[model samples]
Target: MRHHFSEQLDLVFDELAELCITVQIAVRQATEALLAGDGAAAERVISGDLDVDERRDRIEVRCFRILSLQQPVAGDLRTVVAALRMGSEVERSGDLAVHVAKVARLRMPRTAVPDELIPVVTRMSEIAVDMMGRTASIVAERDIAGLVELRALDDEMDDLRADLLQKIVGPGWTHGVEPAVDLALLSRYYERIGDHAVSVAKRVDYVITGERP
Candidate 1:
């Protein structure tokens, strides 16, 4: 029975790793669609969010089953609880990616990001994607050390968002208010995605150390 329960826990971890990968891909593709003004790609991302939701649901169910039946204690209990919380974080990241795609779709044929601001937005997306990648590795490897680097990347994301916001509201701004609003929202979406990745990393730390970061 102990061996069976251990196998079950391993399966849960494997599923969580795959879910993180899915979310990472979503973030990358959503950014590509936004920059290229590809309505088809944007639509694909919007539609794919349902898969993320379903995956999170399955993870939650498995964790709850382990909690109720196996009644995991100590480190095992922490792992199960952390998995539950991490699933929600990853799901929210996926939704943020979908939000980015929706903005891209809304401005189809013409890129939502202005030409001058494209570099900043692109960098922000790069950082967001990188954070998600790191998050997936942390989940799979249970490397608590990676949390430091992940948090640093998130700080960079925050700084980029602040810079973008300044550009939108600065004296030299030429883009109309509507575009400004969209850009602001897009920056927020990417930043929030990074934030979710950080949350997942902290949860992984909790799983390994039994203490929340």
Candidate 2:
């Protein structure tokens, strides 16, 4: 029975790892679509969101099943609880990526990002993807190895969001208010992606250390 319970716990971990990977791919794909003005790619990202959400739901169900069957105690309980919470965070990240794709689609043939601001949005996407990949590692290792790294990535994301905003509102911004609004919304989407990745790390840390990081 103990071995079977351990196997069940492992399933929860495996599902979470897959969930993280799905989210990371969504971020990368959405960023590509946003930058390239690829409506097809953007559509792919939008369609893929349902798959990620379904996987998240499966993870939640697995967590509850383990708890109901095994009645996990102490650290075991912590791990299961953390998995449930982290799955939701990852699902939100996936939704953010979908939002990015929707923005790209909204712009139609024209790229949503202005030429000058491309570099800023590109950098934000890179950092968001990096942080999300690190989140998977954090869950797999069941350690705080990426805790500090996640925080630093989030800080960079925030700074990038601010810089993007300044460019939009600054006198030099000639892209017009509509385009500026699109960029502003895009920056927020990427920043929120970074935030969700950090939240995943914190949840994993809690499971391992039995204390909030």
Candidate 3:
């Protein structure tokens, strides 16, 4: 019975890992579509998000099964609870990627980001993708120090968000309101993705230390 319970817990972990992979692909495709203004790529990402949602549901169900059947205690109990919360974060991060793709689709045939702000937007995407990759690794390792690092990394994205916002409203702005609104929403999508990654890491920290960071 003990061995079987252990197997069940491991299966739950596997589901969470799969969720991370789907989210990574979603962000990469979405960012690419956003920069290139490729409607097809954006559509692919939007479709991929459905798979991410399905994976999250599987993780939640697996966690619940383990809780009710295996009756995990102590650290194992913490692990199952954290998996539930992390699944939500992973799903939300995937949604943010979908939101980015939607913005790209909305302005199809024309880049949603202005030429002047392309560099900033590109940097934001890069950072967001890197953060998602780190989030996947942290999900497996559950490192407390890594949690601290994740928090600091999000601050950098926040700073970038502020910088991007300034460009849209500042005196030198030449792009009209529509493009400005698109850019603002684009920056926010990237920032929100970063925030979700950090939230997952915090969830992991709580499972490991029994204290949320």
Candidate 4:
């Protein structure tokens, strides 16, 4: 019975890892579509979000099953609970990517990001993607040490969002208010993606050390 319960827990962790990978790909593709102004790619990202949602639902169900059947205690309980929370984190990250893609689609023929702000937006995407990748690694490897670097990457993402906002509101701004608003939303979406990744990593840390970080 113990061995079977362990297997069930392993399956839940495996599903969470796969969900993280799906979210990471969504973030990358959404950023690419945003930068390139590819409406088709953006549409793809928007539609793909349903799969992420479904995966999260499956994770939740599995976690509940383990809780009901195995009655996990102590560290095992922490692991199951963390999996539930991490599933939501990654699913929300996927939604943020969809939000980024929607902005790209809305802009249509022209890119939403202006020429001057492209570099900052690009860097923000890079950091967001790196954070998601780290999240996937942390889940699969159960590496608590990687959480420090993941948190650092999140801080860098926040800084990039701040810089992007400053550029939008600074003098010599020729893009006007509408584009500025769109760019602001894009920055928020990317920043939120990093935030979700950090949340997931922290939950993993809690599962490992049996203490919230």
Candidate 5:
């Protein structure tokens, strides 16, 4: 019975890892589409989000099955709970990517986004993706220090968010309201993605330390 239970747990973790991969790909594609103003790429990201959504549901159901049948205890219990929380974060990450793609679609033809902010946005996406990858590794390793380091990404994202906002609100923002608003909202969504990545790290920290960070 214990062996069977362990096998099921491994399957659950595998599914969760796949969900993270889907999210990471979606986010990268969305950022690339935004930077290039590629409407077709944006549409692809939007459509691909449904796959992530379905995978999230599968993860959640598998987690519940483990709890209901396996009745995991102690450390195993932590893993099950972490799986549930991580599933939600993965779903939210996909949603953020979709949101970015939607903004890309909306701002087509005119490309309201300021050229100066492209690098900043790109850097923010890179950081968020890295942090998420780190969080997933931390969960697998149960390393407290590694999990704590992921929190620092949040501060970097905050700084980038502020810088982007300042640029949009500064003199160069005289371009027009539509572009400014799109840029502002897109920056915000990217920042939120960073937050969600941090949230995942914190959830992993909780599973390891049994205390929320």
Candidate 6:
């Protein structure tokens, strides 16, 4: 019985690692699609979200099984709880990626994003992706300091969002109505992504410190 339980634990860890990798790839694809203005690539990311959804379901089942069968205690119990929470966070991240892809598709062909907004929006995407990557590592290693750093990144993204909005409303922004609205909406989406990454970091803090952020 002990040996069988050990084997199951190993399997649980493997599945969690694989789920994290899928999340990172999804985020990267969405970022690249936006930067390249590739509608087809953006579509692919939007469609591929089912993969993350399925992975979340599988991870939930695995966590429940480990809890029911192995009867995890102490640190092992905390690990299972953390896995459950992480699964939710990753699913939310996947949804955010889908949003990014959707924005990319909407802005293509006509070049909805203005020249002034492009650089700021692009930089926002890059920073959010980096934060997500670091948060994933924090989850894997349960690094408290890394999680703190992830929270710090939120301020930068928020500043970028503010700056982009100011540019859109400024006298120089003559991109017309449609493009202006699209740029505003895209900035909001990027800021929301940063928020979600911060949420993930908070979860990591909970997992490591056993306290809410």
* Counted clashes in each candidate structure: 0, 0, 0, 0, 0, 0
| Candidate 4 accuracy as lDDT | 0.88
* TM-score of each candidate structure, all chains considered together: 0.96, 0.96, 0.94, 0.96, 0.90, 0.85
lDDT string for model 2 (1-213, tens) is 789888887788778878888889989999889999888889899999999989999998888888998898988888888889889999999999999999999887888888888898899999999998888888876777779978998998998898778878999989898889988888999999899888889888788778875
For model 1, the run of ten residues with the poorest summed lDDT: 204-213
- Model 6 global lDDT (CA atoms, 0 to 1): 0.74
RMSD of 6: 2.6
lDDT, candidate 6, 1-213, per-residue tens: 668766765665456556666766776777667767877778888988998899889989988988898897876677678778778877887888888788777777645566666678778877777776776676656676776667677888888888878877889878787877877877777677678767766766766677755
Ranking by lDDT: 1, 2, 4, 3, 5, 6
Looking at model 5, the pairs that clash are none
Locate the minimum summed-lDDT window of 10 residues in model 3: 140-149
Candidate 6 — worst ten consecutive residues by lDDT sum? 9-18
Candidate 2 weakest lDDT stretch, 10 residues: 204-213
Candidate 3 residue lDDT tens string, 18-80: 787788889889988988988889999988887888889988888888899888898888889
Regions more than 4 Å wrong, model 5: none
Better of 1 and 5 by lDDT: 1
- 1 or 3, greater by TM-score: 1
Q: Pick the candidate with the highest lDDT.
A: 1
Model 5 Cα lDDT, one tens digit per residue, 1-213: 789887887787677767777788888888878888888889999999889889989988988998999898987888788889889888898999999988888878645467876788889889877876776666555565775566677888899889878877888666677877887888888788878777776776777678755
State the lDDT of candidate 1 residue by residue for 1-213, as single tens digits.
Answer: 789788888888788889989988898899989999988888888999999999999999999988999998888888888889889989999999999999998888888988888898989999998998888888887786888898898999999889888888999899899889998999999999999888888888777767767
Better of 3 and 6 by lDDT: 3
In angstroms, how far off is 136's CA in candidate 1? 0.3
lDDT of 4 by residue, 125-197 (tens): 9898888888888888788688889888888888888877887899978989988999889899989989888
Taking every candidate in turn, the Cα RMSD to the unseen true structure, in Å, is 1.1, 1.1, 1.5, 1.1, 1.9, 2.6
- Give residue 131's error in model 2 in angstroms: 0.7
